[model samples]
Target: MRGKYIALLVAAVLAAAAAGVGTAYVRQAGRPTAKTVLPTHEDMQSFVQTANDWITERQKTADLSLYMADTQNGWRSDGQNLFHTTDGGKSWDAAAPFYDGGAADFLDATHAFALAKAVHDEEALTGISVYATADSGKNWRHLALSGAPYFSAEGITRGVDGFSMASSSNGLLILAGDPAAGSHESVVFATKDGARSFTKQADSLRMPNGQNTLALADASHAYLFINGSAAPVFMLATTDGGKTWKEQDSGLSPRFTDVVPTYVPVRMAADARVAMLSVQNGTPAAGAKGKTETADARMRDVFYTLSPDGSVAGKLTELLTDLPLDAKSVSMPDAQTIYALSRAGGKPVLYRFQAQGGWKRVESATLPADALQLQFVSLSDGFVLQKDAVFVTTDGGKTWVKRPL
Candidate 1:
């Protein structure tokens, strides 16, 4: 229902890599100490980086790619191995599984789906392949797609660089030239019947040209977010399942001179009408002829909320504009209650949003500065997944109890 976990977690992993530290030392420094009550920004960064590495290492060793759990059940897989639990992630049972090492989507306890590369001649990738399991990963079957787009003809091979599965049957796949070729063109394909069939969405979506991702509220409602090097960010949405899509004109007119607008979608609300997008202004570097420029040192960590109809309805809010910390997660439990977490001044800061008040800091002695992900099942019941453990909160993060995985 919310955006996928990998979106924010990937940034955390990069933060660790960029900091040039290993997971072992980072984890050791992350422990809360009696002498140091609050972790500094560097401490929190190490914690995040360590946690990201822990998860990655666990996935690799355990042969699992993801972990998804509700109140009473959980699911995990790594393409080759599959595991499920009935006791709220306390223990898991191994099942016979198939490995594709591809992007997967889970609808319920028994049904799951994924999209992987379909190669011909045991060496050449010819098209995108679909796989499914209805018995909680006990077994899987490759489904035949009806309208999938292919870039392979004659001697050329266009590979599937990006793929997203929305539901058991609906998904999108992007085809492009060699990753080293620096091609700006891409094609998108859509499937509605659990990958039993597909329809070519576009040959060239243009502007946010190549790299892309997907966010879907359901089988009928989905959005495509595109990322490009020199182009403005773009978004496309479909209300009638995946039958048709229209670009959500991001009315991002930069107010500052000598710069251009670059908007990135951080989180999309459940209603799909409201979304939080990160805004950055880029200025051409000196002697680079407006061709190469670093992020304006003056660029503030600004975020704005807009409607799918392309209206900036919320006041643009800036957090620690003087610092370089960026937001990792944003959650809207309801239409009015929004929560966000970001790194600033070398520490993680939590924020709560009110109707009239923009965003206010949440102050608590027990609040964690090293959380990797936040999952709010309700207004009062939420879970914060960290590097070494998971924490449960019933009083809206005022207090927390460590829950074992």
Candidate 2:
């Protein structure tokens, strides 16, 4: 009944747009007017409520505006209603037309995208429905997959794992399916017209641990880093728009018998030229014997640089190995400064690395974890998005202030 109610409310908004009743065709952010359906506050009364006891859930935020999955009537359902807050997670507005599930790439404050994919019985793939919000989720427009397949192969459950958008009109979606034990393979699809349409790519990645992270530098270049099922750091690079992908050697290959690196991906990022990756390295699995939990092994977290096209470019650099296992890459504001976030003990801690100096405990953020991504548009201007709070920093990572959600 909750799903039906949400669906009816969305339909009513569309109906109003059709009848030209209460609507705003104002061209914001160079948005096309033909398919725009502006959602009103009253039309989405279900989104805003007096701050209740229900715990808010977190997803990737679209720019600074947070996209949340809040329960209807303080009760969880099959699908939680999507809501957005532009004012530092203060008052949320209903982004009802857009579902809050699946992989999302919130490009900026105005443009965001997601794949509202459908699966059956948690096994069989069902549909590929893509949606985009050009006006920051104020209005979401449905995009045609045109004829994109729901599943790249026969599988019971398929999920949109990630989105890498190089620009407003060019992007890629990776779907993980064909689960085995707990891991699955990945299928690729892309769009060139701001997701107006989509087409599946010929290339797919079949790794033991599947894809770890995908970053598209441009329309022609993309990099996929795996959890190194075969090596300490395994990577694939595509130069021909993913029509072909080739393995990249990191020069740190581990021997199966003499040497095997136990790798745990901490965080990684890449541009068109160089890729930055950090991994938590346990003792050499092949020869560790009984020294697997040695202090030296626990402190072997490393930072590496490689060519974005899949070649080793720089020597291995080690970071503060004491970082939490869930430490995520924050930003590379400059060549000498780096930032990372670790959700250790359910709390977020920020760390900064300075070249020639070392890593420093910047600030133990008060915000909660399960935060999708911490982004910095500039050197001092950065944001830490929580479920119901936003942490803003202006002096690099030295201090932070929380904002209401």
Candidate 3:
């Protein structure tokens, strides 16, 4: 059965590669050099002050306007106060907070929501707060939900894991979990009358061990990747506003964890019709001599699964063969383009794929000493947040510019 599953997985991956579904490459032209357009000291001072003030104010009143990409400065907010830029990280600004009172989500300029968790210390007490902002983060209002689960010290904590909102309406959905109490769950809520009121459609989802991550496609569809006892399991298609869900049998098995037998969904993406999950598995090798020695050394593999129209379409693809893994990150700019950030040969590297095409290296000059945490903002731009400053790249990372924060 394992062999059959593996064969099917390989076939599906090859088919996708052949279809040109994720194969595309761009070449580096010149020696990578940093542009001289570094952020000034005055700009850094202003940015730090703004960010600190935002955090402080949120702690005090929890009221603020969410704004992004003001024409004065080409700043785009990922959430409240988390800003990024395409024109060489020049300036910065603040935006709205998350639904659970953490940070906001900037799907674009106009449609965004925040996730706020009502927790004290490691315990989630009662009430989960969600806020949505229209008008490009100018104003935000509470999303009132009917029978939204109110948490007390006795109830489990619904720590916000991920959230999803639709572009058409103020409808919103949030996924949360309680890791401290060994509870993994998700909830679905929707607001039709602007951000005024929401309706709770489902109870929380309970996976075997816990849920590592959740991704929502829209108001009606979402996916949860659950870490099972020995393997990673996938829950797909939460229709009827996440009240009930169906398992997607992709003929793909997720990577397993030996420490606690838990699985982590490193990356997840979905469109209106399809969803993709990338899972990581770590296991002890067979050749090792003793339990302690063998346990210390392990092998890892990363796999990808696809769901077409909220249903499993095919087997999984072994994107990376057996090797020692450090950290992996994947980003889907659009439905057809995927970017992966991984550490190869002990150095950070970026790879890009257009549907059907195989992975191709994104050539960029060597980063500064101990420069890790490279984040790809888009296909054409990326950044590395370092201790001293944040580095930015505009030309497919071929050239970079530093912006001090």
Candidate 4:
């Protein structure tokens, strides 16, 4: 009975976010192009200055804050700055120098931590640092990790794939890494004393042979999704503050295509009931054997539910069919609200899903051609990074105005 329920849940979640078949776009040759309206250097400078001023004013009073990483350098640290806004992103401020990975968490209004990797000799794994700030964005303290670490590089550096921060509390931080060189050696680190020190906790969880993706419910609970192996395995709960973990039934087929991790589970209404979504490649079983033709016509399934008591619940919901060919990111602001960003019609589009309304298409504001990363900070606030600039929307993404800096 448990096995049957698990199978059903898996089917439901995967069935939810799939996209339906639609007409592809065709371009006509020799079409006249519209004139580009680029912002001037001075105009951009003034915009950034204004954003900084707005941030300074809001810091005077705000309960919580969300900061977005600049995605111009492919979300790297070289030329980007951490743009943070307190009052629902109406204004912005720059954080101190930090590496550009998708890892950051704010313990409070005046405290935050970011995972960064240092580059030396064209190699990014040499120096891995975690930057912490106690007084909001004023001053930053860098804590470096010795020895080569996986997933420390910014983008596709050839070693590890993704590095993320699961949870942080009481000076203890948990970081998850997917190393390419080491099979069955996905790494997770636990640091005491505010990342000043570190201890390896990868051995606690029995990760599968290939790559593993992880998400945290809070400082104490985390979920890991292992793929690329014969059968997919899941680590549902991690005790000892992410040091050691125990497995739970994922109800997924052994095969999955892509997995994206998120940090929004920490903000769920109940910390004990955490949620993570995965888009599984649903090509028929017969064609799954080949490498070339099997990759084509791959379907996607979006699964969302609660991971509690070593199992998932809350009815696996099927959201879409034949989703975007290059869907990059999906975020769940809450159990009921889900947002997905993908390139459609040669432009980025935002899709919103509510518990009651199903899926609705919404127009996204124009973004710079270079802007690549999109993150939904909250149900009402979203941000996109283009080069050195950050654009934010506070009213549920209807209008995305630029918040320079």
Candidate 5:
């Protein structure tokens, strides 16, 4: 897409006006109004200048530091400092500085948790300190962790591989891989009474273990996608916090001999009935010694599933089959909507997926070429992570607003 193109958030207002007029006509005339007129390509192009002008102004002043956003809040991190905004990206204030490397989960304006690795601890290679802030990012306190992901067998401590929080009282910490052993196993730790305590959910969870991710719909419902090897990818779900889990059958092929499949869980509805997955397939390439093969590859297709609320049983249907080979990311906020980013003809392109509709190209202002990470607070509210900053869209992807850190 070209930066000169105009966006069509105007359609949002048009749709609402049509709905109101249609309702009034039906009530007065005892019949529905005619179908609303669709805007022509010329009409859409008329918006190009307006969008280009806004983008030009933003580019002149963009700081390119904002890293995360939700419906009501935003977060930014420079190399050593972290900042936060609560009034929908109007302004931001510095929160705290992280020395080495860390990850944080901000549930809302008042509650947040951060994990930072110790810089000078030589004996404990993976030593981490947990910090919690309750005064809306103004103050922070160190919280004690009951147990961390340390393994006696390997004699090496493992830092947090992933972190997520559903509420002030519920969270999950995932630890995978070994610095010394190169293992493909994952262990899940759950917290119920805030960060006061943590416990291993069960036995060590075995997965295909390339890159795994967790999606928590709430304190109760969540899904875990483990990118399997040559075997079937594991799609695990939990309904009662992390106490129990069930491996979901994706209804795809049990195994693929021609192409190795990797599954990325995109989104799980709050009801847990609607879910989306991105499937990546690649031919195995011979390793250095020809004794093993690697399946590092790009995405091939996008699929979605729908079942009863909170149940893992569902039917998998392939949605977009004709994506660019360089398509690297997909995010679904709901069952019927998706935003996929990829490269086309050596340039970046973004696509939108809808239920019953295969895929449509989004031709607004161009997104950053390195845009990859996507987070959606709802079907309409979402954020995309670019190389340096976060771009947010409140009306799906029709238009985006930038908040530079």
Candidate 6:
């Protein structure tokens, strides 16, 4: 973003803003271009921005409040970029080019790590690169993982599931595969020197009779959500740093008996509750749309608490069961609150669920189009991810402004 821009690119952003976020004139899909084509500075002029508008109103009353996302939802010429706001969600700014956003673990304002994709060819995902930043986005250090289990992009593009950083110097890096491929394989790596180096922990950690999803409680603790032949939300725990795994009786299997469905990977650290939506007798609403959910897709929002010991807290609370409209996109900000993005009457709608009242529509003036993910740091401030841009809501999902990414 530093060297490509000239005076002419400003005109292009103005034109893009007019045609709207969804219709960017210079949009290209799938990672960078094919390996055969060498990209140029001009090619990035469309997606890359000089910088975002500075936080319009700084809030000095609050002690440094920040919300951030290593946004990787959209098409990008320079891998994934990090966007953050210091004063709640009053405004946001692009922090740095953090590749493989799904694998990003932002420990705080100054420390982060991610598994960078070293594959130039979009066809074969053959290699991986480790990136760590200590002084925020100002600089990054490339780490060594000579024997790291590389990602496989056989056909469908699956990304790094997540990176769990318990502290500045310890973390877990996970890469998952397509769930539709009968059996799922994920590689887990553990690092003690802030990802400066890592040890391959799990190359083929059993997903026996089904697909698997990884839920990390921290660096050494991980929960495996086994779907398909197993019971719904059936899990296995690895407390000894992913060396071995064993099934645990979560004790909530009886609650999800009716959830004849698929699994949605929940990426939260210890003590964080995640809402997993299960489509009863139908495919998962997220990636599977036109498969079998033609009739009413009865969905349920179930919350699970991940313990520090890498086990589901055994308290599975079912909320919003058999709703006509699925919280197709579900996020549990806390144990008591949930935010969901679903289509109502063929248009996207945001709903907030509370223990006090139930699901209620949140009226937002500027939430445009469909959102890919929702990240709410508090009850009031949050970030919504779209394909091309990120929208920030400072007033409890009522209004939003576009942030540069």
TM-score leader:
1
Candidates in order have lDDT scores of 0.49, 0.46, 0.41, 0.42, 0.49, 0.47
Worst 10 residues of 3 by lDDT: 1-10
TM-score against truth, every candidate: 0.65, 0.63, 0.60, 0.57, 0.63, 0.59
lDDT of 1 by residue, 1-405 (tens): 343332311221111122221111011112123342333446444554543454344333322233344555545553444566666555667754444555555556677666555654555545656777778777777864323236444324354444555556766655564443434455666777766666777665433434445656555566665543333446677676544667775554322212122233444445533444343233323454422323322223345555544444564455433222222355555555666665455466666766678767766556665665555545665655555455666777677677554
Question: Best to worst by TM-score, what's the order?
Answer: 1, 2, 5, 3, 6, 4
Tens-digit lDDT string for candidate 2 (1-405): 000011111110000001111111101112123643333434222211110101111112222223222211111111345555555444556564546454555555566666565433344446666787777577777863422364434453345445667677887766666567644667777789888876778535654553355666667676665542423345677776666778875455221111122222222234214344432222223354422322121223345555656565664345443332221234554545556765443356676777776787766444445553454444565666654566667776667777654
Error of 2 at 191 (Å): 1.4
List the lowest-lDDT window of 10 residues for candidate 1.
20-29
Please provide, for model 5 over 1-405, each residue's C-alpha lDDT reduced to its tens digit, 9 standing for 90 to 100. Answer: 000000110001001001001011001111114543333435323333332332243333222333333576766544356677777655768787642335566555567677776534556445556677877678877754423443444534355545667677877776664533334556667888777767777436555433345656667666665542323445677777666767776545421122223444444445334444433222222342311322212224535453422344543344333222111255555556667766565466767777687678877674655553455556677666665556778776667887653
Between candidates 2 and 4, name the one with more favorable TM-score: 2
Q: Residues 95-146, candidate 4, lDDT per residue (tens digit)?
A: 6555353345544456566656655555434545677776766788887764
How far residue 112's Cα lies from its native spot in candidate 4, in Å, is 2.1
Lowest-lDDT window of 10 residues in candidate 4? Answer: 1-10
User: What would you estimate as the lDDT of candidate 3?
Assistant: 0.41
lDDT, candidate 3, 172-255, per-residue tens: 454454543444565556666644666666656555443333445556655555533223334455655567877665445222
- Model 6 clashing residue pairs (backbone): none
- Residue-level lDDT tens digits of model 6 in 114-157: 56666657655445677777775568798634322443334332
Superior candidate under TM-score, 4 versus 5: 5
Superposed model 2: Cα runs more than 4 Å off: 1-83, 118-125, 144-157, 180-186, 203-205, 209-211, 228-233, 255-297, 315-317, 325-329, 334-336, 342-349, 354-373
Tell me which of candidates 2 and 3 scores higher on TM-score.
Answer: 2
After superposing candidate 6 on the true structure, give the runs of residues whose Cα lies further than 4 Å from its correct spot: 1-102, 118-127, 147-162, 174-188, 200-204, 208-213, 226-234, 248-260, 265-270, 282-296, 306-328, 403-405
TM-score of 5: 0.63
